[model samples]
Every structure is written in structure tokens, then in C-alpha cells.
Target chain A: MSQPAIETHDLTKRYGKARGITDINLTVNRGEIFGFIGPNGAGKSTTIRTLLGLISKTSGSATVLGYDITNERKEMLAHVGYLPSEVFYYDGMRAKDLLKYAASFYDGDFTQRIQDLAARLDLDLSKRIDDMSLGNKKKVGIIQGLLHSPDLIILDEPTSGLDPLAQRTFFDLIREENERGATVLFSSHILSEVQNICDRVAIIRDGRIIETQSIAELRRTAVKRVSVTAAGEVPLNLATLGLPAGSFAGAETEGPQTSFVFNGDCNVLLSALAARRLADVNITEPSLEEIFMHYYQDGADRGGAAHDSAAQDGAQR
Target chain B: MNVYLFEFRRQWRSFLAGTLTQAIVAAVFLGGMYPMYHDSQKDVEKVLAGFPPRFAAAFGITKDMFSFGGFFAFIYVYLAIVAAIFGALWGLKVFGREKLDRCMDFLISKPASRMGLFWQKALVVLTGIVVMNGVFLGVALWVRTSVGATSPGVGQFVLMALAVGGVQLIFAALGALIAVLAPRLHSVTGLGVGLGILGFVLSALPPMTNESNFKAISPFSYFNVSQMQTQGTYETGYLVTAGALCVVALAVACVAYVRSDVKA
Candidate 1:
């Protein structure tokens, strides 16, 4: 079998007393659009930096494209393209010049690729880097990262500074790159971006991988946000509705309407609500943030540890 | 190698302008003084002799004040100060500019190793100093030979230039070391100017303190112009110390730079 595109085993990095990342074990298969989802300061960037060897790992080990990240950093980096959260380049260089310099490091002809990306992104190649706006600079970063046609593309909050139109184009470009057999590891706090593209996602919290699942599996686990507008005044107490204990989170009620996130069996919830007077009801998938909160609501008791063994098996399969 | 070429090209224009400015200033300022001193040799010597002993020593004045070599040595003391500061600033920018500008991510994420990048930057620093000193030496030589002024012979002037070059090199390495050791340094140029002025002041301290071992601490004293002129060569012991310091500092800089946790 082919080796995974990227893999880490118990990677940890501690900056004196502060925790950078702790015991992060991850596996991204070849040709997969893997999402690394976490909020700010959640160790997403820390983990990616360690894999790219931008910072040394304090313990454990990792490999990218079959090369040990710590020992064979140069060789590993040859096939990896990284776009950091904040992009900085030589201020005096023109956009084209910077792209050319980036291309010079990899042994290939990237002229056509660069030109295509620049034209599609509407980037002004002649402009000096210092003069470009943040969005334009991000475009330059995207071009430089993809110009080498790397095997693994790692993006850390890659779309933060892009306009909506540009973002659509960038996503299209990523899909095309993936179609061309490039594996992508995208890190972002935004949910829709991950939902739209990622095949699998690993949700991180406070430097630990709390959950890893295929997008379908993750969506299945996410509870529904149910809203009910009763024909008559409903009881203010939601616990008397007869759903599983603690299944209702952040339950709140108005004079005739009620809403709460439901995490238990749908049949039990339907039976509990059937006895109410005729009313309007709406059920939808909970927001990613709400789902994330559920996982974090009860630390370690919410099967985060149980999911670890399942995730390991899932990784192997 | 690509990074090296890119950095060289990016900096060459400014480097050329600054070095030429230094070279022209040195040639015009020092070369212009030679004829004035020579024509009024008697008056210059009488005026110099009447100055207090402390002032004379402060300015590195001795009995050979009327000769071409002595005047050349005297003028070089001031020139070395400017060159050393310029070299220090050059060295500080070698690694500091990347960190200051937040360009570490771009370089560090590339296929190159950290050691490779450090060495490339170190090479650029060394080359910058060499090129700057080369211009200074070239212009000084041209002014002396072309104008046919009352100046030291080619051999003595070359020796003096080499000594000044040594001082510049030592400080340049020191600056590079600081760049690696203090990755978050805010004012590299300010530090360079400060060190240069401090060295200049300390160079005068040894004379006032009766040739104490304290002189060994400053690069400015490594190439004592008075001793170079009278003895016809740089002090072998001090020269060795300067060379050793340059090597050790540069090596430490490379190791520190490679081991540093680059903050993107």
C-alpha cells in the first residue's frame, strides 16, 4: 500500500511553560482534501508548522511524503507547498519576481502555471509587493505556493483576506489542483469552507485532536437545532417535554415558541413534542459552533477519548 | 544558491550607492587635507606642538606629524570609525532584516535548510563588508597616486587600509552575531552607531590609562594607527585576536541562527 501523504505520531511541542501542541496524532491519506478545523489559538497553526519543520517538535515524530519531518526536513519540504496564516515576502520584489524566486527553488518549469494563476486571480504581476493590498498579497502567496506544483498543499487560514469573488475562484482552483492528484491539508476556523470542500475533518481544541471523522460521519453526529411555535402558550420548563435527560442544550422559550438543540433519538423527541397543541416546527442541522460546543461541553466524558480508538481504526481503513 | 543570488540582486543597488558615498567622502576629505598640511608643514607642526599633551594623545598625535605616513595614519583613525559603523549596520541587516520584516516565513518554508539560509546570509554580510572596504581602499589609492600628493607610499597605505579593513571585519561579525542572538532586535542601526561611537571613545581610553589591558576589549584598538605607522605593520598579537574573534563570532552566529525557533 502507498504511504499516507502526511502522518504524525504523538507530536508535541512546548514553549517553556506554554503549550504549543500536545500529543497530536494525525493521518491524512493520499489524494484527500483533509480539513484541520479549530478556532484561533487552538494549535492548528502550531501543528502545521511542526509538520513543515518551521518549528522543531519537542517530542514524538512525523513524516510528510514518506520523509521524516525533523531529520529530512529539506527533502520533505521539496514536495510540500505551505501558505501561512500571515503572508510576508521581500518588500522590494515585484509579484512576478517573487513568484519566480519561489519557483527557482523547485526543479521544474512553472512559468505556465504562474501565468495561469496570475491571470485567473487578476493579480498585477508588475506591482511591487510593498504596494499591494492584503488581498493582492494573498493572491501572490497563493500563486507562489502552487507554482511549484507540489504534491501536498498545506493551507493555514488561506482565504482570510480574499474577497468573496476571489475566494470562489481560489476554491475552484483548489478543486482543480486536487483533481490533478495534489493532496490538500486545509486549516481554518470557518466551517462552511471546510464543509464545502473537505472529505474529512479533525476538530481540535486547546492543542488536542478532540475528534476525527469523515464529513458524513461528523454531520451525522451533529444534533439538530429544533424550533417549535406552539398554538397555545407552552410550559416554560423544557425538562417536562420528556426527551432524554441532558439531550436538550441551551434550551430557551418564548410565550408560544421554544427552541433547543436535540442530540438524542429523533423518535423520542418527536413523541415528546406530538402531544403539544398544533404548532409549527422547524428542524435543521445545528451550526458548527453549536456542535463544537457539544463536544467541548463535558471535557473527556463526551467520548473524545473513545473516538480516539475509532479514529485510529478509521485511519487504517 | 537561488536565495543567495536573489538577495545579492535585491541589495546590490543600495550597497553600491552607500559604498561609493563612503569611498568618495574618504578620498575627498582625507586627500584634501594632505596638501594643506604639506604646504604649511612648519605652521602645522608649531600649532600641533603647542596643543596640550592630553589633546595630542586623544587625537593620536606623535613626533612624526609632518611626514606623509603620520598624517595618513591620523586621517585613517577617523575614516575607520565611519567604515566600522557602516560595516556593523551591514552585518546587522544580514539576518535581522528578515526577522524585522517578518519575511522569515517565506524563507523558512522554502526547500532550503536553516543552516543553508544562515550561511547564505553570512556570505552576503561578508561580501558587503569586502565590497565596501574595496571601494574605500581603491579610492584612497587612486587619490594618492593620481594626485601625487605628499602621501605615504603604496606599501604603507596598503598596510593602513588592511588594518582598517580588519577592524571593519571584526565589527561586521559582531553585528551578525547580535542579529542571530537577538532575533527581535528593534534598532539594529542604532546599536551599530552606538557600538561604533563607544569603540572610538574606548580607543582613546587606553592612552589616558597608561596602556592598560583594557585596550584589548575594543575592535577600534585592534588596528592602532599610531602603532601601525611607527612599527610599519599591524600588531601581530592584536591582529590574531581580531581574526580569532571574527571566526568564533561568525561560527556562533551560524549555529545560533540554525537553532533559533523562527517566529512567523
Candidate 2:
């Protein structure tokens, strides 16, 4: 079997005892669009920087395209293209000059590729980088990253400064690269974009991977919004419902309607509801945000710790 | 190689123009005053002879101030001060270019290693200094010949210019060291100018204190203008010390850069 395009085994990085990332074990299959989803300050950039060998890992090991991130960093980088969250270049350089310089470091000439990407993205090659707007700068970044036709592309909040139209064009270019057999690792705090493109996602929180699974599996099995209207005043307290804390939340009481989100097995939730005399009940899959929130607030809330660990099991299932 | 060439091309026109213009102007103005000073040489010498030795040394005024070569050497000390500032500013800009511009991510993410990046930047700084010195040498020789101060031989002129160049290198290395050690480097040019002034002040102290050890610590004292005019050589001990300081500063800068976190 071929090696995975990207893999990490117990990878950890710390900033003088402060959390950077911890015990991260992950795998990105060849030719798949993998998502690394997390909010700001959640170690997403740390992991990406470590993978690129821009920063050293404190412990554990990782590789890109079968080359070790430490000893073989330059070789690994030869095949990887990265776009950081904030795009900045030498201020005096024109867009064309900067792109040409970027392309010179790699193996092949990228003149035609630069022209094609620049024309498609509506970037003016003649404009100085310092004089361009933020959106235009981002467009230049996209062109430089794709100009070399790297085998692996890594983007950190790639669409942050782009307008709606520019973002759409950027996504189309990414899709084209995917079709050309380039594996992508797309990172973003925004769930919608990941949902739109990723084959699988790894949700991170507090410097740890809390869950990893396909979007389909996450929606179908792990979390569901449930509403139960008992025949009489139902058990309003979650502890009395015989379900674990975080397994259910947002329980509200209204006239003949009591509802909460259920985040565990559908069978257990249905059986629990069967014990109560009910006028009606409904079970539905929740959105990705709700599922992500379950992991984000894992230990912060006194009642959600159980659900965070249970969500890990759901990911495995 | 591409990065070095790009930086070199970007800086060449403005840097060479500004430095060459300043050197030419200084050479012309200073060279023009020599004929006037020589015409009244005996009167000026009698008046200067009455001042205390310490006061004369403080102003870089020597007993041989009546000679053309002596006057030129005195003016060269002031030129060294300006060259020191120029070198420091160039060093800070080239060494801290990525951090100052907030482009560390763009540069470091490329295929080059950090060590390779450091050497490339150092080459640019060194090249800028060399070009500036080259222009200064041409202007100095032309001004001396045009103004009829042909007493100093070609070898002596070369040695004096080389000593000034040595002082510039020392300050440039100091600037690189400071750029690496400071986290923010908020105003690199300001820091460079401040340090250059400080080094000049320290160099001026030995005359007042009557201590040769004070001369050992400051690069300004490394090449004595009076000694260069008379003996036609820089002090061997100070030259070695300057070379040692340059090596140590550059080495520490490389180590600091390789270990630093490329913060966004």
C-alpha cells in the first residue's frame, strides 16, 4: 500500500510550557481534500507550521509525502505549497516579479501557469504589491501558491480577505487542482466552506484533536436535535432523564412542548423517551456548527465533559 | 541566489545614488577649503599652537594640521562617522527585512533553509558597503588630485580609506547583532543612528581620560588619523580586535535567527 500523503504520530509542540498542540495523531489520505477545522487560537496554525517545518515539533514525529518534516524539510517543501492567513510580500516588488521569484526556487518553469492563474483571478501583474488592496494581494497569493502546480496544497484561512466573487473563483481553481490529483489540506474556522469541499474533517480544540470523521458520518450518527412533548409535565431536569450530561442540552419547557439537542446514540435517546408518556417527539440531525460546539466547549461547561468524550467515540463509529 | 539578486537590485539604485552624492559633496566642500587654509597656514598654526593638547585632540586637530595630508586625515575621521551610520542602517534593513515588513511567513515558507537565507542577506549588506566605499575612494582620490594636495602617496591614501572601511564594517556587524536580538526592532534606522553616535562618543573619551584601554573598546579609536598620516599604517592590535568583534557578532546573529520563532 502507498503511504499516506500526510501523517503525524503523537506530534506535540509547546511554547515554554504554554499550550501549542498536544499528542496530535492524524492521517490525510492521498488525493483527498482534508479539512482542519477550528476557531482562532485553537492550534490550527501551530499544527500547519509544524507540518511545514517552519517551526520545530517539541516531541513525536510527522512527514509529508513520505519525507520527514525535520531532517528532510527542504525536500518535503519542494512538493508542498502553502498560503498563510495573512499574505505579505516584499513591498517594492511588482506582482509579476514576486511570482517569478517564487517560481524560481522550484524545479520547473511556471511561466504559463502564472499567466493562466493571473488572468483567471483578474490579477494585474503590473501593480506593485504595496499599492494593491487586500483582496488583490490575496489573489496574488493564490496565484503564487498554485503557479508551481505542487502535489500538496495547504491553505490556512485562505479566503479571509477575499470578496465573495473572488472566493468563488478561488474555490473553482482549488477544485481544478483537486481534479489534477493534488491533495489539499484546507483549514478554516468557518464550517460552511469545509462542508462545501472537504472529504473528511478533524475538529481541534485546546491543542488536541477531539474528533475526526467524514461529514456524512458526523451528521448521521453523532449528533441530533430532539424534541419531546410528554403527555404531562415531563422531566425538565436532564439528570432525571437517565441520559448522560452533554448527551442532551438546551432543554426548554413551553406549553405542551419540551425540546433539547441529543448528541448520542439514537437508540438510547429513543428508549429514554419511550419511558416518558409522550404526546409527540421528533428527532433530527443537527448542523455541523452544533456538532462542533459540542467539542469546543468540552470541559468548560460543568455539564458537557461527558459529551466531549462520547463525541470521540461517535467519530470512531 | 535569486533572493540575493532581487534584494541587491532593489537597493542598488537608491543606495548608490544617495551615498555617492553625499561622498562627492563632502569631498568637494572639504577639498575646496584646503587652498584657503594653506594660504594662511603659518597664522593658523600659530593660533592653534596656543590651545591645550587635549583640546586639539578632542577636535581631531593635530600639530601637522598645516599640511594637506594632515587636514585630509582630520576630515576623514568625520567621514568615518557618516559611513558608520550608513553601514548600520544598511545592515539593519537587510537583516531584519522579513520581520520589519511582516513577511516572515512568505519568505520562510519557501524552499530555502534559514541558514541559507541568513547568508544571502549578509551578502547583500556586505555588497552595499563595498559599493559605497568604492564610490567614496574615487571621490577622495579625485578631490585630492584636483585640489593639489599631492603630498600623500597612493599607498597612504588607500590605507586611510581602508581603515575607514574597517570602521564601517564593525558598525554594520553591530547593527546585525542588534536586529537579531531585539524582538520587535520597532525602528531599525533609529537604533542604528543612535548606536553610531554612541560609538563616536565612546571613541572620543580616551583623549580626556588619558587611558589607552578606552581606545581598545571603541571602533573610532581603531584607526588614528594622526598616526595614519605620519606612520602610514593602522594599529595592528586594534585591527585584530575589530576583526574578532565582527566575527563574533555575525556568528551570534546566525544562531539567534536559526532558533527564533517566526511569529506572525
Candidate 3:
């Protein structure tokens, strides 16, 4: 197996009494688009900043492209392209000027690379940076990050202010970059985008990773919604058909129709439904948002210790 | 080398603006002193009827007020003020603008050391000061030759300008240090100007009060242009002290800059 493109061991960042990110252990594989899903103030940016060496980590070890992040910051930074959440640019500078200024730092034919990327992204190089809109500014940032063809591309909320078309174009560019052997670690609160692009995702909540898995695995383990139409009173003991007892959370009855929400394996629920004598039944797969909500809510209720234990188990795997 | 050239290109326009402003102000100040030079000789005779010519000579005015060196000295204080202000402005802007524009990351990401950046910026400011003084000296020489006067050799005039440039450099380095240490202030340029004025006042006060001890505290007093006028030369100790203060200020700035976190 190839070495992990990026790995962090028990990363913790504390700002005085407040916690930044606590014990975040993550591993991202090469050429994979890994999504870091979290809500606002969930330390997603903090983790990305730490990885880029934009901010110091309180205690942890992280390696990118086989270089230690702390000891070999400049060397590691050369191989990593970072897009900060908040973008700032020099005043009165044209986009082309800014790109050239940034390009001067790196070796190789960066000018041609920048020109090609700008053309592909449809960015107007002659426009002044301050005059550009937020979406255009984001495009400028994207071009700068990817122009060098870095080994690891770390983006914090890469599609926050983009229109749907722009977002799709960005994802396509990211896919192309990945195909070129670059690994991507993108953070987002929108689950749909993460679901669409990411090969694996780590769901973070309240400064900790609650779950990390492939989309397919999450879908298979996520709870299913079941709607059953019964001719008469439905039996409460549905587990007799082989579904887990706790799977049948509750049932809603409207005259002859009774619908149940199951919080367990969808396949088992379907088997139980097939064995039942129901007049009508419908099953719907949970959306990524629903799955994320379930895991986040569950983790919040259980608190940090349980989440850490589950994360440890995932890490060990 | 690319980083240095890039910074130079990026800062050229602003530096040009500052240099032009310095030239205009210096022209107005030196031009205004032209009439005062001719009037001072007549006034000296009337104001000191009983004083000996030796006493008048002690003050270093030989009644040839139109001479290039004398006229240059007549406006040297104002010229120094302009040079100091220009240096301070450049210093503050060079260090502080990066923080304000959030471009420190862009610069630091390059293969340039922090101390190297500080020195490069200081060099740029010093170069501009030299160029500005060169223009003033050129103008003074033109005026002297047009009126058919033979003045001091070019080397002597340049040495005197270098002395003033040394003093300007000390204040510029100090301004850069302040900008690096306190980047959040909105009025860093104003602070630099105020500090330059304060240095001038502190340097002037000790001499005006005839206290040699207090003179050591101000870098300006150490570069005593008036004493240089009487002796036709500057003290080696003053030049050493000015050079030492500039080095210390730049050292402090470099240490602080390399260690301080770049606040975006």
C-alpha cells in the first residue's frame, strides 16, 4: 500500500482555556478526495490551518507527503496548496500580477501552468483583484492553489460562495487534479457536495471526529424510513420478523395506515417488511444530510468520551 | 534575488511618490532660504556692531552667504527634516503595509529569510534617501555655479550629505521596528513622523541647553551639523554613534520580525 498522503496522530490545539481541535487523528490516502464535514465553529479550519502550518498546533504530529509538518515546514509547504476560508489580496493589484508574484516563489514553468489553469477556470487575468466579485475571487484563489500542481491540496470551504454551476466546475477541476495524482482534503458543511465528490469523509462535530467512512458504507449502515399501510391495528412487536428490537423506533398511525421509522440496517428492515403481512409498504434511503444529522445528534447526546472511543476504533482499523 | 527584485518592483511606485514629495518640499524649503542667506549678512553687521569679526567667524558665517556650502547649511536643517520624514514614511509603509494587506504570508512563503527582508527594505529606504539628497546637492551646485561661486569639492559635500543620510537611516530603522512590533495601529505613518520630530527636538534640546550629557541620548545631537560647519568636518565619534544606533535598531527589528507571528 502507498503511504498515506496526509496523517495526523492525536492532534490537539488549545487556545488558553478554550479548545480549538481536540485529539483529531486523521489519515487521507493518496489521490483521494477526502471531505472534512462539520458545522460552524467545529475546528475544521483550525485543522486545515495546522496542516498548512498557518497556525501552530498545541500538541500533535502531522506528516504531509513524507515530510514532518513542524520540522520541515517550508519543505512541506512547497508540496501543499492551501486555500484559506477568508481570502485577502494585495490592494490595487491585477489578478495576473498577483499570480506572477506568487509564481515567483516556486520553481519550474509556473507561468505556463498559471496561464493554463486560468484559461481552464475561465478567469480574466487582466481584472483587478479588488474589483472582482466573491465568486471570481474564489476562482483566483483556486487557480493559485492548483497552479503549482502540489501533492496535497487543502481547501477550507472551497465552494462556500460559489454558484451551483461554479461549484460543479470546481468539483470537476478537483476531480481532474486528483486524476493527476494530487490528493485533496476539502472541508465543507454541505453534505451533498461531500457526498458527491469525496471518496471518504470524516464527520466532525464539537471539535472531534465522530465517524469516518466511505459513502457506500455510511449508506449501508444509516437508518431507513419505512411507511407501512395496515388494514387494521398494527402489532407493536415487529422485531419477531428478525429486525432488531431497537430498530423499530416508533410508529405513526393514521386510520388504516401505520408508518414506522427504523434506526438500523435497511436490508434487515426490508427482510422484516417482506415477512410481514402489510397491505402496503415503502422504504426510502437516508440522504447524506440525514445520516450526518443522525450521527452528529447521537454523538452530541453521548458526549466526547464515546465519540473518542468510536474514533479510536475507526483509527485502529 | 527574485524576492528582492519583486519587493523592489512592488514598492517602486510608492517609493517614487515619497521621493517626489521629498524633492518638492526640499525645493520649497531651500528656495525660501535663498533670500534669508543674502539678508543674514546685513543683519549680522547691524545686530553685532560691537562684536569682533572673530566672534562672527566663530559662528562660521564668513559674510559670503551665497557660497554653496553656506547656502546648503542654511537649509540643511529643513532638508534633514524632509529626509527623515520621507525615510520614516517609507519605513513604516514597507513593514506595515504587508500586515495591512495580509500579504505577509505571500512574502514569507517565498524562499526569503525574515532578517533578509528587513535588510532589503532598509536598503531600499536608504537608496531612496541617497537619491533624494543627490538631487538636492545637484540643484545646490547648479545654483552656485550659475552665480559664479567656487564652493567645496564634491567629496566634501557628499560626505556631509552622507552624515545627514546616516541620521535619517537611524530614524527609518526605528520606524520600521515600531511598525513590526505594533502593526495594528492605524496611524503608524503618523507615529513615525511624530517620532522623527521628537528625535529632532530631543537632539536639539541638549545643545540648546548646553548640556553635553543629555546630547548622548539623542542620535541627532551626535550628528551635529552646526559643529561640522565651524570645524569644516564631522567628529568620528558622532558618526560611530549614529552608525551603532542604526545597527542596533535594525537588529531589534529583525529579531522581533522573525519571531512575531504575522497577524492577518
Off by over 4 Å in 2: A229-240, A252-258, A277-280, A302-317, B50-52, B148-151
lDDT of 3 by residue, B234-262 (tens): 87777788888878877888888865655
**lDDT of each residue in A1-317, candidate 2, tens digit only:** 77888999879999998999887888898899999998899899999999987788999999899989988888888889999988999868899999998998888889999999999999999999999999999989998888888889999999988999999999999999999999999999989899889998998887877788888887886578777776876444557778976577666778778777676777887777778778888877877777787565544675456545744553343
Query: For candidate 3, lDDT tens digit of each residue in A259-303?
Result: 555676667777766776777777776677877776666566556
Q: Which candidate leads the pack in DockQ? A: 2
lDDT of 1: 0.81
Task: Provide the RMSD of all predictions against the true structure, rounded to 1 decimal.
Answer: 3.1, 2.8, 5.3
TM-score of each: 0.91, 0.92, 0.81
lDDT of 2: 0.81
Q: What is the DockQ of candidate 3?
A: 0.31
Pick by TM-score: which candidate is best?
2
Write one digit per residue (lDDT tens) for candidate 2, span B1-264: 977987788668746864775586557655676777778888888888898888777667776666777877666657777778877887787888777888888877888888888888889888888888888878778877877776778778777777777888898888888887777767876887787788778877888678889998878888876677788877888878989999999999999877677886
Chain B of candidate 2 achieves a TM-score of 0.92
Q: Candidate 2, after superposition: displacement of residue B253 in Å?
A: 1.1
